[model samples]
Target: MTITSVIDPAIIQAYRETHFCVEGDAPLTLRIGEKNETLSALHKASGATSSAFVTAWNPYSRRCDDETNADLQKKLIDELTTRSLCFVNGVGRHPASDWAEPSLLVLRISLEAAKELGNRYEQNAIVWCGADAVPELVLLR
Candidate 1:
């Protein structure tokens, strides 16, 4: 079944077009609804069945200054640390847009927990992937 949301089509399209890049030693890029062999290998290596690419910037899609966005992102990273979750720093970047939001590729997060985090961060949606490694757009609102 297709998950539906109240978010605008244009915004959803923008989300789909974004390159969710996971940084560090094994930096990789993910796109919504697409499968990536690199991510699949990472998941296998890490023994992670699922992951979520999330950002705390521009809550509910509203523009925020760099400092504010960074502050919010720090909080998000803190939360993950508190939960002892393994994650790699990342960003959601749209090629056509200069704006890039700080993000994370949280490994082994359950769908429920990912949804909760998305809502908690006031994000319109998040990119989540299961064992198949196909990233899906999970709308929070």
Candidate 2:
């Protein structure tokens, strides 16, 4: 298994400086594919809890192998609607590698935000937060 680590200190620093705000409601661009709608889709899907490029795979795609991106996306949607947890996808993957690129996706929300999603979804959702001001995952959560 390979463990891939990706950290763009510049991006993080920029986000910190700007308080993680996007301009004029413009969607954040992700690095995996050129498509710009992931951020906006995730934002609307996740109720704007947070936005970031995450590492997820679509099983039907040759790149994903076993998991369909649709499945992954659905899982995230459920997580967001039920629990209001944010979904971030961006990291790239290589064959035989364990980790994907664009590793860190932030979910910044008040406890009230969490509560607003209600209990059923909240009960089904869980988030793994990072300790070092950033977090990494082996799979695309």
Query: In terms of TM-score, which candidate is strongest?
Result: 1
- Worst 10 contiguous positions by lDDT, candidate 2: 132-141
Q: Give the alpha-carbon lDDT of every model.
A: 0.92, 0.35
- lDDT accuracy of residue 86 in candidate 1: 97
Q: For residues 1-141, write the lDDT of model 1, one tens digit per residue.
A: 876788888999899899999998888999988899999999999999999998899999999998998999999999999999999999889989896888999999999999999999899998999999999988888
Which portions of model 1 miss their true places by more than 4 Å?
1-4
Q: TM per model? A: 0.95, 0.29
- Which 10-residue span in candidate 1 carries the lowest summed lDDT? 1-10
Q: What value does the lDDT take at residue 134 in candidate 1?
A: 99
Q: Tell me each candidate's RMSD, in Å, in order.
A: 1.3, 11.8
lDDT for each residue of candidate 2 in 10-36, tens digit (9 for 90 to 100): 432322222111222344533222334
- Would you give me the overall lDDT of model 2? 0.35
